[model samples]
Target: MMSDDLFETRDSSSREVFTRYNREDRIKKASEKVRQLHDPDFIRKRSFIKSVTENRGLRSVFFVIVVLVSINIAFFVTRSDKNNGRIYGIKTELKSFIYQDRALANLRLSENTKFLESLKESEEKDGALVRVNFIFLDDKGTKLSSSLQTGIYMGTELRFSSQDESGNAKKVQAEIYIKEKLLVLSSKIK
Candidate 1:
């Protein structure tokens, strides 16, 4: 009779065991749904981090691009500053030459002062030839206060000038032809 009672208890506990298993399964499914909803972007962020960490070549490419861009900016800034510094030297030399030529022109009055003729009339052996035309007008067509025409030849030996204000060249322009081609165009500023 005890064996029959044991069989009855075992049959009853089976139902309770099933109920506990169902409760645990429900709790696990609910936790999984909550995780998916709360951390929707977790998968994408993990994939991105893994890809960057594993690919050495991609990381190196990014580093090289940054280094090259920085170097390019530094080189450009230094080169531009150097070019600006050279302009001051050119301006000072040009001003001194103009002042010296003006003072000397006051002494020579007998020479026929026409204008700077073509380079064909003169020869440039040293290759440094500057033909200056006494510009009488500005960019707005305003006349300058002084008028003088001189050409810097080779190393400052040959110069041409006009006889007087009336005989001076008009619309003065200096053309620096290199190898017989027009390379630079300069005008005298009074």
Candidate 2:
């Protein structure tokens, strides 16, 4: 019983000592932290401002580059053939005609015929059948025409048809080349 009392006393005193020591250590650490916070060499305020400005500058530059690249890509995809502006003009006119008045399908078809006839002349002459192909490109790189077809006409359906020398008429290839991504490459069956 006596030994138990002694042990209890010793344990209590040790615990008290440890608690006091920890309190002193905590005070010392807090003081040191306060001193460091005020130290001139730390550059806490200046570094913070500099870092914020640098981060903002980098973010703005990145955003601007993304916007520029997107615009360039849109232009390259929609600009049509610069060499044959007439074809592009015709294409634009057809698109406008079809969309401006939903009832102008016949008018658009007639206009499309003229453009198609002009395009026939530009077909790459192969052995038996003429090959009709165009390259599509963007600021990023060559884009598949099929990829852009969804966005074309802004959710309006566009009709495409091809008539070969044998009078074999078929729907135009669903795939399109945006910037030479090889959306469609039909082989000559002849």
Candidate 3:
């Protein structure tokens, strides 16, 4: 024999016992609601937008790819290989020499065509001096004579006519050292 008050259910307990909707049913309902609010074409068009918004890793990868592509394009557009392709200096044919009283060595220095073209292209940008140094070496690689010349542009001829008291003419090799700004070029003439 239980008491009626003990057997009676309370209103708070009845209220606390709530019903839960099914997962599939809730998803269907939400989809229907979305379809009613937005056009089908618009939803289809924006499906990728939802995916990109939900997938953080995918979005990061896409952002990185875009940045890399942009960087590559910028590098290709702004890069120039003109300086690397330039020629620094060249040794020209030796001119005639007069060796009456002594041994005379006549030499010519010429600017490389490619170097001149590059210089012309950047003439408006900056100015630099090109120093040409001529060295005469005998068969034994001994230094016979040397001369230095400086110019902003163009080529020049070097004439060495002063002969020692011996007045003996000797076959020697000529070397030209060209210094342009920070570039150095050396060449031997036969």
Candidate 4:
């Protein structure tokens, strides 16, 4: 009897216990329970938590996208300009930097030029002495009589206004400027 009772199969009589589950009955019961709750804040919090838990991958994807975009922005952004921070095209940025460097170089060159000019001017003001010799040459390039002239060294030039041995006012001639080791002379008699 005991062996037979243990081996025999019996059909369940309870409908709830025997049948497969469906969501319709569960949904209706859950909705009725939710309606009994009167607090909107509580419901909102619970729904938000449930939604976040269910769609977890969406949040991760959104976070990854945000991080990538921020990194991209960082790579292109720069504060090299001496002004308010703002984005500019790569070509425009390069041009501005190049122009700024050129301007600075030009400024330094101008300053150096001014300093040299001032030093030269000081030498001239101090009446720096210079020795000059005038050699008279004939048309055949033959050496003639030589004479000495009175002149002053004006930094790079030797200038004087003096007459010839005959003391003629019109014969006054001065040779000036031997810049960069070059000398040119042209005379016209009217």
Winner by TM-score = 3
Cα-lDDT of candidate 3: 0.46
Off by over 4 Å in 1: 1-54, 81-190
Q: What is the lDDT of residue 162 in candidate 2?
A: 26
Candidate 3: how many backbone clashes?
Answer: 0
Better of 3 and 4 by lDDT: 3
The lDDT leader among the candidates is 3
> On residues 70-142, what C-alpha lDDT tens digit does candidate 3 reach at each position?
9998997664211111225444444323355544444444444555556567753232454545444444556
Question: Candidate 2: which stretches are off by over 4 Å?
Answer: 1-54, 82-190
Candidate order by TM-score, decreasing, is 3, 1, 4, 2
Ranking by lDDT: 3, 1, 2, 4
Better of 2 and 3 by lDDT: 3
lDDT of the structure predicted as candidate 1: 0.37
Q: What is the lDDT of residue 20 in candidate 4?
A: 38
TM-score of 1: 0.23
TM-score of 4: 0.22
* lDDT of candidate 2 at residue 164, scale 0 to 100: 26
RMSD of candidates 1 onward, in order = 17.8, 18.7, 17.0, 25.7
